[model samples]
Target: MKHFIQQVLYALIASMLLLTACTKSTPIGSELIDQDQVELKFRDDFKIIAKSINVDSVKTYGPQENEQLNSYLCGRYEDPVFGKVEASIFTQLALEGAMLPDFITKEGTVILDSVILSLVYDSTKVYGDELALPQKISIHTMFEALDRADTYYSNQSFGYSPNPIGEKTFFPRVRDSL
Candidate 1:
């Protein structure tokens, strides 16, 4: 009985660690990935990551409103001759908490009059700046400054109104190249 109890405890601990480890970005390998795999993983993982974001309120922007996302098609070039340059083009908005590193970035914090979290995960099934996405993607909200009865947002001019950036679509090496 004691041995069985020990095994159960060990399993619980291992499962907890595994769950925590997966909350961050997905692991990528240099091996070539087929477009189908990219599409499947990108779609599935994106949904999962979006479900991870925690926000007081959410309002999805672009696409459904007969609009195109102002995504950024950035490329990384580090030649012994050419210098570093990065560019951002059309992109869309995402939900809170599920912000990823590669594709998406830290736009700013969002506030709301009430804590509405159900819609925080609905920003999925959409593409990022690029026309296509890569295989295996994820996002993390990381840090946040949430407060009720106060709706103070950093960049309220355009995006992040009711949505937070969970995942983004961008070049893998864009950040490093620049």
Candidate 2:
């Protein structure tokens, strides 16, 4: 009985030790990025066409509705407190004939770089008189390929939208200025 007890005690200690070793380290401020800067970059310059929205399961994405619908299903929505989301993305590119198995971007920021971002857009009909293109957004794009450890931007997946003012024909995310 004592031998069985000792074995159990040893197992418990081993388990505890393993748990301690497995604990992951907390991330530092390095990963944090400024969303305002990205927005400002577009607000200031405002000219990058979005090519596509690559996701984990390319198979699931469809063209019938496009990125807007995709964003809605994923988890983006307009909340009184959070503001507009999912609606924020305005794509000049069509969802039809899009390639599969492409991780074009999983997470992104508003700042400048290879990728660009634009939270503001025209709320008119799907094909209304508007820019009709997604701003090139910077994903967790590295400042330097050599410094793979270093990152410039961070993403939270979805954005918030403010309450709508009128029964306007415009969609939600299309902000007036940008």
Q: What are the Cα lDDT values of the candidates?
A: 0.40, 0.39
Q: What would the TM-scores of all predictions be?
A: 0.16, 0.16
Off by over 4 Å in 1: 1-69, 86-138, 145-178
lDDT per residue, candidate 1, 5-80, as tens digits? 9999999999999998886575485247764576542344443322233354322233243332333233343334
Clashes of each: 18, 19
After superposing all C-alphas onto the true structure, candidate 1 shows an RMSD in angstroms of 24.4
lDDT string for model 2 (1-178, tens) is: 9999999999999999998896677435534766444332235566765443434332222334442232222123344654655522212322345453444555743332332333444344333333433433222322222222222121322332333221223223445532
As a whole number from 0 to 100, the lDDT of residue 5 in candidate 2 is 100
Query: What range of 10 consecutive residues in model 2 has the weakest lDDT sum?
Result: 145-154
Which number leads on lDDT? 1
For model 2 the local lDDT of residue 155 reads 31
